[model samples]
Target: MPTHLWQKSSYSAEANACLYVSTPDDATIRLRESDQPDTILTTTPTTLHALIRSAKAGQLDHLSTA
Candidate 1:
């Protein structure tokens, strides 16, 4: 099996927990947190785009109690 080179945004703090993303295949998107590397979430590009759009629009803010 080939290794996926996970990448995180340059804007994220180097010493803090960050979200890492990887593409194991053309149709798959993988996400994992720095603090919890064993847990991964997978989604498609379309779904990921929608998530970003919703996040940017603050639609998910209500779900967070913070």
Candidate 2:
């Protein structure tokens, strides 16, 4: 993967709660965390989009221990 292709989430820069992502191909969404960059979660754009929406809506709040 090209180094330039991976982008960190905005909050990653300001906090250790890092999230990184890449789109290696049109059909895939790749996710990583700074604490474990070698591991990745691959998904479809549609699913990722829905996840983002749910997260932003606080629907995922129950999963958080914070």
Give all candidates' CA lDDT scores.
0.89, 0.87
State, as a TM-score between 0 and 1, how close model 2 is to the true structure. 0.76
Q: For residues 4-59, what per-residue lDDT tens digits would candidate 1 score against the true structure?
A: 88999676688868889999888999988899988889899999999999999999
Model 2 lDDT on a 0 to 1 scale: 0.87
Candidate 2: stretches off by over 4 Å: 1-4
Task: Give the per-residue lDDT of model 2 (tens digit) for 9-64.
Answer: 87767667599889888999899998888888999999999998999999999999
Best by lDDT: 1
TM-score of 1: 0.85
- Model 1 weakest lDDT span, ten residues long: 9-18
